[model samples]
Target chain A: MSNGQETSQETFAALEALKEHYSLPSLTFSVPRQVQGLVLPVVIAVVWEALAQTGILPANWLPAPSVVVATLLELLRGGELLGHIGVTLARVVSGFLIGALAATLLGGVTGSSPLVRRVLDPTLQALRSIPSMAWVPLFLLWLGIHESSKIALIAVGVFFPVYLNLLSGILTVDRKLLEVGQVFRLDRVQQVRRVILPAALPSYLVGLRSGLGLGWMFVVAAEIMGASRGLGFLMIDGQMTGRASVIIASIVLFALFGKLTDLVLERAAKGLLGQRGIEF
Target chain B: MGLAGAHRAALDIRGLCKDFAVHGGRVTALQDINLTVRQGDFISIIGSSGCGKSTLLRIIAGLETDYQGDAEFEGERINGPGLERGVVFQEHRLFPWLTVRENVAFGLGGGRENSRGESVREHIDLVGLTGFEQAYPHQLSGGMAQRAAIARALVNRPQVLLLDEPFGALDALTKIQMQEEVLRIWRAEGATMVLVTHDIDEAVFLGDRVVIMSNRPGTIKRIIPVDLPRPRDRGSYEFTHLRSAIYAEFFRQEDKPFAYAI
Candidate 1:
């Protein structure tokens, strides 16, 4: 081969070798970035374990890590932990579904038509400003102390974020794209279905993720009234008998499940909308 | 090619006047704009910045409907944007979410009416973007993106094609290349085309008749017809004559920064 051609071939081989070397270290570690996040939590756990063992704080008020783990394992063995998890999961899932569906439908309507917005937006905005927890007593009176009351509380919590985001998202779609729709002689219905919906999708996903987090937060407050089997009930029961370890165990489970469910939502959102440059 | 085809008006506008409400006062954008585009004609409207050339194209495309006087398409009163006239705007205006093939095929599936003529693939090939069908608008180069935009407008097989500064943002080399691509597509499709631009050479190179407009409250100042043969030589005497003839309309009033005397 000519000298220029030979050097080009050598350069190509060199680039291949460089890429392989660059990829090897990360491949061996397999998600080093994710593991790097664990360092802080592990440090906190070790500090807590050491402090409790040395009795720096009173043993009765703050239980040791060992006591919390032993109690959690005990609950798991009898299947009572599974039952508590199931009941809480059922409440959160149903409330989130009902809230998301109603908000999306109503928001779409009010976003497109000024008449609907004039009729409903003022009242909805008035409702949105009131703290969600204030409704707990009213819902207790209206829906009672059954699953219905708990689910209603969670549903109210989930609605506003989704509704507000969907309204703004649909309204903010690029006017230029809508002109393209107009040039093609698209009707209003086709414009919404094709152009408006896809353009607003990334914002809707943001609303969905935030609403998912708020749903978990309200489940605890919802179950505080007349609940006897959920994770919230376990927490209240431990507080009543002064078994701080049981209360702490339930709080730990809440934190873990909250993170786990949010992680699943983030992954699925990325899978659906990663190409459009939307991040959770 | 001459006054022979002028009698058969494809697009005819008479005593046209348009105004915009700007800063609580009326700003006249076009005044007494009269022009006739024949069937199978290639007409170019050339003017300076803020001269409302784009507004004229918009009116013809049915995107602007509040103008004074009559702007008719084939003797029908223009109402609003429709499928019969296809427009390629200054920017590519391709949806970032759509692939190249999908962007071109956007209007073909269903619009005002489903037109049956050339397929999407044929238009894509006409614009010289066959292999990059699956590429998104962001991934394509500027010229490639403009080509995709052209293909999208042509896929409709519209009775009239309207372009508003379609290649103004491209580099010099790419703009010339795209000018040739447009001429090729025009010959292949044989549709009436109206291009509005500020570049004098682009008007003379692409148009059978170059219509020069005066500045703000733009009006048809002059019309120069090209009598040269197919693929006219850019360096030849006749080509330079016609090019200078169009330039003379603007430079007729020298010692002024603007192209026309207000």
Candidate 2:
């Protein structure tokens, strides 16, 4: 055992020495990272310029990337894009918050108790099956063609996924862990806080990510239905005015926002659970 | 070590019978089982698979209350799980979301809020997991997680610690090490322990008396006293002899068809 330990120590030392000998320049940089971020957009702009110059497609149908950028810059300066974007973002955030909170609380209750699970399960399942768009007309009827209708649609869209995921996560908590809690005589609240809540978090986070994405989708769909403001309304307005550039710009912005939101969610999840190193 | 003047046994099993209704028919898991465990008794139950050793332990733990017989602790009938009887299952079953400290603290009772943090810390230290208190179950190795489970069970200071193949999932080296650790902890805590395992050698090593059971619809075949001193030598002639003797009894029960049939 002593000899084996010495050999392993020598092997580790050799590996470290090799790593130091062949070390490459560190890619770590403050400014270079920002430049790297611009690479994709710059490449796309160059490609668009080349295609427009070649006239491979009709100019009106496929406007140069510069033209789209100019249109976006003009819209921003006039406060049109900003106002719509702000409205759309506010709706999404409020709707998603309401849905996520309600789902989490209800999911926790149903997951811990069999009777509650039995009572609520079938109804939730029925509600979940109804498409988010299908609820737009009904919500409009109930709350009128207003912000409440859009928010309601988005909230319903977000609720089902979060609720199902959280409930399953709670239900699947290892019985052994519960036994451990029982042995200690942990009260119901402590058990929920210490065992049930934490155990259900990973699954809950997954649900949150998907729920937010769906919320974004439902918000756009709701805005398109009747709203006179927001990004989705802007797209519909652009369509009516035949401003292809504005339509394309709004779509691009929505995609970018979605990507950014996903990235932020991923980072948040990693920060919360990275140390524990839960694989799933 | 003395059984005298301890009132009645810490746990007493009388005419214990457990049956499970399977798809085929009613399968008897335990039949006419009787045992008495004095305070601080370390009893190991060993048998082949389906011999219902674990069923007996579960019954005593009050986890399985549907059994036909009675389990009494200090003259009171055993009911559902309580702080007095703690069970450690085969899997560690530590809550994945909870840190080691939190998991241990959970066993200290949720209603007793004021001093929980202190008690949880004490149990974590008792299990030698003081530094890893903030580490979640997913962060710990299998052996360490099992230790956390043990710590959780011990947090309630149960009168009896029932272990059902607690070390069965561990590697061989870890299993032996855990056996010793359990022996040391048992001595220190002076809690009555009932360990159920399929390994004869393990039963002989940890048990004051190894209880061998017959096959399905299980009943005790025999009780063999282990006279080895503390820190028992596994390689000693007496130890090996007793191990082989218990192994032989297990095989002998296997050879007899329906030895414990209803």
* Collision count for each candidate, in order: 0, 4
| Candidate 1, residue A63: how far the Cα is off, in Å | 4.6
How does residue B22 of candidate 1 score in lDDT?
Answer: 99
Model 2, runs deviating above 4 Å: A1-49, A186-194, B1-3, B111-122, B256-262
- Lowest summed lDDT across 10 adjacent residues in model 1 chain A is found at A24-33
Encode model 2's per-residue lDDT on A1-280: one tens digit a residue. Answer: 2235568999999999999799887795545755888877888889888898799756677778888889999999997888999999999889999999999989989988889999998899988887768877788899999899899889888898899999999988777666666656567887787777877788999999999999899988998888899999988988898887888888888898878887888889888777666553
Looking at every candidate separately, what fraction of the true A–B Cα contacts under 8 Å does it contain? 0.46, 0.51
Docking quality category of candidate 2 according to DockQ thresholds: acceptable
> Tens digit of lDDT per residue, candidate 2, span B1-262?
4447454588888998899999978999999999998888899998888889988887777777887888888788877677888888898887665678776766654443522467677777777887898787877877899899898888778888999999988879989989998998898788889999988879989999998898866999899999899789999999999988987786565665545643
lDDT of 1 by residue, B124-221 (tens): 88899989887877677788988999988988789789999999888899899999989989899888999999998888889999998988777888
lDDT of 1 at A206: 83
C-alpha lDDT of all candidate models, in order = 0.86, 0.83
Tens digit of lDDT per residue, candidate 1, span A53-88? 999967679988889999899989988999999999
How well does each candidate superpose onto the true structure, as a TM-score?
Answer: 0.85, 0.86
Per-prediction DockQ scores? 0.32, 0.31
